[model samples]
Target: MISGDVDAELRRLADDPSFPHRDAARHAIRFRAEGDVSDLVAIEDDPHPCAMTDVVFAMAGSKRTWLNWVPMPAEAICNVANEVGSRRAEGEDLGLVSLALSAAEPASAITASERVMGRVELGIGDFPAPDIRMPLRRGRYAIWRYDGTDPVPAVPAPSGAAIRVLHEVGGEPWSSPLSGYVQAEPLGALPLADLLGLLAHLPGPPDTPRWEYLAKSTPTYWYRLLQPWVCLGILRHAADEPWATSTRREVLLDLALGIEDWTADAALFALVTAAYRESELRAEVHQVVRARLNAAASAPRLVTIEESLAHLMLITPGCTADDRALATAVLARAAEAGEEDEDEQAPPPSKAEKRRWWQRRG
Candidate 1:
């Protein structure tokens, strides 16, 4: 939409080798004039390039420097604590003592970091789940015994002392290339319109081998956005947004089937896990699985795709007969290609694994 002398001046700035902000100028010009010249941009120059970056930049304000994100809902605190407890019980060197403090009926805590904030609550009749842990942060935590009902940040209190310095909880750092988003702002601060804008403008499937190879090196911010806990939390918070109604499901289905990387599995995982509570999403997942299975007949099945199929069989609820048949045929194709079936290799768990089912990127 940019035209007139302004467009000419911007283009000149972008093309001027001596202009210190030439790259920014180029991005501005590219942003205003649509149609992807992304193909022409060097990977080094656009390491985490995606429409989401544009959305995040505009929404977060141009004056910021770092992105502060809360990766999970408050409920995930209990999950993380329970897993740490489990690991300690098994004599593993998780290096943390277990705490069992009784709070009057409902226990509440406030989870806050840099820009994001949420509250964790354990209701009177309900206790935390056994082995469904989701990690939130990665650092040393101070655990204190407080009797009052005032909300606090913490892990479960151990039996020994009233206050203790708890070493960092065993969790992976949620670092992404988009960690530095040109400024400091809480992810919770982003508006639903901006979030949906990013979702709607996501790049479609790669059509070129160069893009495919590049995908292996530079991932979109969706890698962080679509993490299981983050995606689930967003769905909960934006229950009224198009995410709850239709936009999320549609975008996820497209990414699950179109994208060909861990991000795709993340998309697929979000679809299946969200389906656990939403019947409409469950139906959508079934349709996606059916279509994906049909396409597997000829498409080159990568490990990511195989693992996605395994997740479908393992976690997807109300699996239909037709869907199962398609999956079986797809696994057969994978076998012919000499790829190991992930499901066959998985050991039955004594308790549900409290981590992402799919392999993590090293």
Candidate 2:
């Protein structure tokens, strides 16, 4: 523990140019200090793991950001992807039973429970049968079902692209809100835009919410995409539809909650009709995300994402830089608003002024 009062320590740290202690202090019982006073009030019940993962999520059902973080050491962000793998292996988390089933050859696993119609029959990624409430118990081991109803929580996928990115540019330990949030650097390999595009192509139970996982899963493809702003943007686009239930809407909610990057992969899926890039989208969105990621531990979700995006130097990744550059451009535009140009501010055109102008023109 650092010496001195919390406020005093905060003051000392605030003087530094860069954001530090940002990652190490997330979700702790003891109160911590922050550069922005707003940051302190934003995370009122922070530090406790159970305070609510989605507190960071804009919506009530939004997914967790930490789980699918491309950058290592997500502070205060719940790393559910890592947990799911561990839990599934131990038979602790029932949610992930589907991954194993999907990996297995056909006829390897059997189910006895009644599955909902149009549930697993159609097609898509192998998913869990959340509808199947109970376990398949028998002789030696209990047989779990994979009806493909539920979605898997993505941590960070370690594909060649990701490894290449990390290996090249590399990452620096992040600035987080959690204490002892650990330190690591980015292997600064610029991310490719088209990772997990398959999410778009997957056919699912039409009647049931096609994009239900957007609201169901704790850490979904949304926040993992690292573009909550994109969700808000798309939500604005579909606000008029009212009853429109496209996968796009579901995808937007995930984006808002930080499950998936809306711009890079999500938007591309809709525009180009691709799914193979969905995971790649998850992987690539990080570029824009890191651009906006503030001290994950300190600022409110809004502020953190904004600040992080604001400080980014270069964003060469999957999606266009419109939203990425939007922050500063907006601010610049706002600043220029009040100042009137001398030419425009000239006295109202009177008879004399008009005559002078006319004479000059002649």
Candidate 3:
């Protein structure tokens, strides 16, 4: 339950005219710090909208944390029209995994999540797979009620299905189901070698039915949403070791250049982070940096590309002069984009432009 003081503080922040993203993020962190159902309901009810990164960071910041939101039977059919619209306006998609990973007490939360998932029947046909992820971290898992609304067009619900209408603060309505969450079994942490072995089984051959299904189910791209988390885990495990020892240099390189922007960003983060601790990885980091700079030359203002470039420059010292030159050109173009952004009326707090979520983990 939300403490009297916490409820009042959230209310005060919501009423303040100058609530910023940082404030919203700090408040969002309360989800992990205090795992009370009423507290989450209060945070959800708060008028100040939160950015997707704020929520992600809160959920993934620690291994022991988890969050499972089980709506009251009376609240199960909630019209999340505003919630849906706000997320779309901010270019975000929420899943059960994202919300449930914020619980402070993972053991109870996991049990609670499993019980809730068992009661909610899975939707049939192309009802869009719920954002299901297993073992977000050691002992932690998440299970939220509503999946994203972006797949509404591509994955229509069967007729007569009980669909929930979602909306942003002021955005149009979109239909989404109130029950798509599924139970995910928790796994123990594996050694680097074992983790690599498990990862090798993913994104299997192109002709398979599973691959075809994934292509149709995922939003916009076929990239695995878990790619970043997995990459980050690998980086954390091998930061102090030589790249050759892990036998996964090629894996990181492939992920760094993957089609999914977030996955690529995570791969680059892993590469650069490792390069800082292991001099042996510097050469590969430089090669990736150069490739990214060249690819970003024409469209320098792209947020993800610029973010990768900035992270490399910040962490990897003594960058090659050629890379520096290319980076300079990209920043020059990005500056022009910033000017345009300044002139446009500011977007909503949740929609405001900012760095990628992984970079802000620090």
Give TM-scores for every candidate, taking all chains together and pairing residue i with residue i.
0.31, 0.22, 0.35
Sort order, lDDT high to low: 1, 3, 2
* Ten contiguous residues minimizing lDDT sum, candidate 1: 161-170
Note the Cα lDDT for every prediction shown.
0.35, 0.26, 0.34
Q: Model 1: what TM-score?
A: 0.31
User: Which scores greater on lDDT, model 2 or model 3?
Assistant: 3
Compared with the true structure, model 2 gives a TM-score of: 0.22
Query: Which parts of model 2 have CA positions greater than 4 angstroms off?
Result: 1-8, 11-159, 167-173, 176-191, 194-362
lDDT of 3 by residue, 1-362 (tens): 12244444544554667755434545445644653222333333345644533233223222221121111111101112223323443556633222211111111122222222222222211221111211212111111122331111111221211111100000111110000110100111225443333232222223434434433322112122233334545554533555575534655665555332333554565565455434566777867755654554543222333534543443343365555566656556556755765777755412113211111011
Candidate 3: which stretches are off by over 4 Å? 1-188, 191-229, 236-242, 299-304, 345-362
How far residue 259's Cα lies from its native spot in candidate 1, in Å, is 2.6
Q: Once superposed on the true structure, which residue ranges of model 1 sit more than 4 Å away at CA?
A: 1-226, 242-247, 300-304, 329-362
Residue pairs of candidate 1 with colliding backbone atoms: 64-182, 64-183, 65-182, 65-183, 65-184, 66-183, 99-157, 99-158
Compare the candidates by lDDT and give the number of the best one.
1
In candidate 2, how many Å is residue 16 off?
13
Q: Put down candidate 2 lDDT per residue, 55-146, tens digits, no spaces.
A: 22111111112211322212111223334323443445434222212211111101100011111221222222311212111122111223
Q: Give each model's clash number.
A: 8, 66, 12
Better by TM-score, candidate 3 or 2:
3
